[model samples]
Target: MKSLRNLLLGAGILLLGSCNQAPVSAPAEPAPVDKAAIVLENIMTRASVRSFTAEPVSRETLQTIVRAGLQAPSAMNKQDWEVRVVDSQDKINAICDIMKKANPNAQDRFPDKNSFGNAAALIFIANEVSDQPGAFSAVDAALLAENIVLAAHAMDLGACIQAGPLRSMESAEAQAWLKSLGFSENYQPMLVIPIGHPDQEVTAGQRDASKAKFVE
Candidate 1:
């Protein structure tokens, strides 16, 4: 019996010796993803879509886009910006009416009577006047608008940064409109963006890269 046990032990030792190997290393973490390239591609593909479908962006999607805007970098991180999302068709139509009155040429320029080009919603970014010198509240609002635009694009929505809305909102009727919408006197509109499902695809033209300079 002791001899049999020794034989079995020798056999097991031989099997282990034949199969002996260094611990197998886990597969190298899949090569790191090129996240930077993906981000750059997204930026490159984004275009200003002036025409949009009637499909309305849901509140949840808008909240996500606004959250991205809220994360945008601001001067001193003061974030002196107020965003008003006008989804009310009546208010949007009123703004269009104001635009027509403000710019008689709007109709001539745009194919549609509505100068807004039938956007599903209007996103207004107002710069709250900051007391800090060189606070650059307008710049902060501009950054916020950029973030909103990018976020909208990422979500398969189209957005265009329009200065026309603010211009139209300057009239007495527009002021009344703004007041009705609850914007304070200090909340001066800096940018008005219209976002919705894109009705048409826009392609980017070749950029004029000659004007750029790089310094070490």
Candidate 2:
């Protein structure tokens, strides 16, 4: 019986070894590293532009940016976010007027006048208060907003994220503006981002590896 057991164990190991040595399908070869580097370089070159052409971003591109923003990480996988896109010249100008009045010296302080421009469209990122705790909601909004910025950049579009305009008012007009856009009671405006093609060239900033901290 002991001999028989030893023989069975030996046979099992041999079978396992044979299986391990058998040809196994491998994953598809990845794209060239240089291709990836070029793609990243293109994305990095994208920058915020205060001046934009008169052209408007197509609905498709706008949708793509919103979809990307929606893909951002959320607490507990609960993605409770809303985006309000302002494209009409009237609406854009109205908001711009409000911003201008809110900060008379805005252009002087922020010479970029980056808050709003000829950029064909604007987007407001909001989060539902009930979806998270006080600060958590803002954090979620921020993550999603960054996604919008990066995605826009990837598409060769320019984006500027601003918190100033939205914070100015709990004014009835402001509430009405948001409510008109179908924002639920829980959705609070967090930030506004303007989108467009850059009129002036934007330079990419170098990445500093030293800023990253890693733990083994």
Candidate 3:
């Protein structure tokens, strides 16, 4: 009985040693992702939104959009762009009045007479025209405008780009208003973006990639 008990203890010790010597397995690898496809989808799904709800956009979100706009590339890396955010109803109305005077039939041409669809906020993109060579200023401003609109879309906010309100800036009243808003004389307003909660849904139009020819 003593010999059997000793044999049993030896077997138990061997089993414990075997358990401690268990092998380690490597971690599973993550699945590969198609980043380009995701980006293309985001761009394709973006649409121009005209109607908007009364809900206002937060200052933090606006800042984020502005940051994205500033990240846009410019000719010779000039980055000569400025953004003005207008949230006051009185100022928006005053601008709209100026627009009406500039083009009395603007309402017939544009869906919203306000030129901003009465959005909660209007972002005006301006550029230092004199600093750019030829049309580079407009091109740079356009790139920034695209960045702003895309960023807004990514944040689930509705935005529309319009150059209609730019006509108002030609008037003395509008120029005075812009001056009061701290815009410099050399800065020219290129685009106006209205941001808010979307009141309508817009579908993406079909694109014909075949229009471009590959020489290679």
Going through the candidates in the order shown, the clash numbers are 0, 0, 0
Model 2, range 35-118, lDDT digits (tens) per residue? 778767766676666667777899899999999998999877667788899888777766666656666665633355434767
Error of 1 at 89 (Å): 1.5
Local distance difference test values of all predictions, in order: 0.82, 0.77, 0.81
Clashing pairs in 3: none
Residue 176, candidate 2: alpha-carbon lDDT: 62
C-alpha lDDT of candidate 1 relative to the true structure: 0.82
Best to worst by lDDT, what's the order?
A: 1, 3, 2
Candidate with the greatest TM-score versus the true structure: 1
lDDT of 2 at 155: 82
Per-model TM values vs. the true structure: 0.79, 0.71, 0.77
lDDT of 3 by residue, 85-191 (tens): 88887898787787677777656324653567768788888888684345587788889989988898888888878886676578788887777666677887888
**In lDDT terms, how accurate is model 2?**
0.77
Cα error, residue 186 of model 3, in Å, equals 1.7
Point out the worst 10-residue segment of candidate 2 by lDDT: 106-115
State in Å the error of residue 82, model 2: 0.9
Instruction: Write the number of the candidate with greater lDDT, choosing between 2 and 3.
Output: 3
Question: Ranking by TM-score, best first?
Answer: 1, 3, 2
